[model samples]
Target: MVIKGLKHDAVAYNTMIGGFCRIGEVGKAEEFFREMGLSGVESSCVTFEHLISGYCQIGDVDSALLLYKDMCRKGLRPEGLTVDVVIRGLCGEKRVSEALEFLGVAMRNHEIAPKRKSYEFLIKGLCQEGRTEEALKLQAEMVGKGFEPNSEIYSAFIDANTKQGNDELAGMLKKEMAETQMPKKQE
Candidate 1:
């Protein structure tokens, strides 16, 4: 296209970057990302999201975080999936504290709210790290935001309640879990 005097736009760059990232060719994708800017195409949130996902997919959470900060510096509000993937990556790396901080900063302040799945990931991370109180608070906030806890969340709540000797809440969650899992009777 350069030979034909057609400059690559954001769409073309995004496609190439996403394609490379999907194929485990993040290096290639980064090359295209650099070329995109050199060609004067503005990088959008989708572009950063794809590259960040590629980094996270390859266990390069640090690079992904750097990219995330860069995106923020450029005034782009990352999409929900981007936040979710980053949280997953940080949690997977056993960096729950850092992930929590990121969630507080990026996800909390972003224009598009992170998905419930993102909250679930953070809750699981906090639970795994034995930070039950913080996890409970996060779960409470999640509930207040109109997000229903999933099975895993129920398990977390049950454990926390039991540890705190709050048998009432534990039993309630148990009953709720049972109710949710019960099959409906046919007429």
Candidate 2:
């Protein structure tokens, strides 16, 4: 296509790569990336983000991190969403510690603070790993950030404490559960 001048640009390659990744055709996506490299078409941050996210979706942390490092080496700093994908993927893979480490790396490397969803993922992962205290601490942090813990997060903490026979904690959580704010009826 470049030879014919029909579509010779990074956007075209990025779009094709994104399409292939979204359709779960990761191998083809990788092939396209390699082809872009061979064709002298530089990969954009979007392209790296897509490929790293695809690898993460497949639970391929090693590959994802390799891609992340390569992107850093190329001076292309990953955005918040890139970090979010890898963090969520790590949690899904039951690697909460690794996920936390990755979160730290993102903070240190990019100086980018995570959003609420990122904290949610880490809290849930911590709960799943039987670290309710850590989860609750994370919840406190979220609250400090002006984001109240959702019902699901509260429930997870309650469940975790209950399983460990921590009735006091459960009681506290139950007491603090979100109160329904019904609207007043008009006269």
Candidate 3:
């Protein structure tokens, strides 16, 4: 298209890359991304996000992580979706600990706020992995971040604690759930 005098701006390049990625041609997407860089078109956060999502969709989370680090090094702040994609990919790989750690670092250092769903995925993965203590801690952190714990999350924790004979903690979670579900009085 540029050969025909169509200006190959970042948006045009990003569209081509995104199209290739959507069709499962991540290799071609990477090629176009590199070519875009060579053509002096600055890559946007959206460009990196497309490639990150493409790598994650293929279960190539390592590549996605590398791309994430590269994006960070380039000083392009990742959007919430970008962080969520990488976190979800990590959880899908059963690397829930890594996901949690990454999320913590991103939140503390980069100030990236995760979507509630990302926390839910990590918590579920942790519970499935029998890391109930860590899951409880994560749930507390999520609450501290102002995310309300949904029933599914509460139930998962309750189930885990109950099965482990931690009735006290399970009861506490139930009480907390009830409190969260209560409607607050308007000031």
TM-score of each: 0.84, 0.89, 0.82
RMSD of each: 3.0, 2.5, 3.3
Among all candidates shown, the one with the greatest lDDT: 3
Candidate 3 lDDT tens digits, 1-187? 8579886899888999999888889999999998999989999899999999999989999999999999999998888888898999999999998998998888887898888989899998998788987888888988998988898898889888888889999899899989987789899
Misplaced by over 4 Å in model 2 are: 2-7, 178-187
RMSD of 1: 3.0
For residues 1-187, write the lDDT of model 1, one tens digit per residue.
Answer: 7899988899999999999998889999999999989878899999999999999999999999999999999998888789889999998998989988887787567855757887888888787666888998998898898997889888877876787788998899999998986778999
Residue-wise C-alpha lDDT for candidate 2, range 5-118, written one tens digit per residue:
785579988988888888778889999999889989999899999998888777787788899999989999899999998888888888899988888888998997887888
Cα-based lDDT at residue 26, candidate 2: 80
| Top model number, TM-score | 2
Lowest summed lDDT window (length 10), candidate 1: 106-115
> Lowest-scoring 10 consecutive residues by lDDT in candidate 2?
176-185
Give per-residue lDDT, candidate 1, residue 106: 72
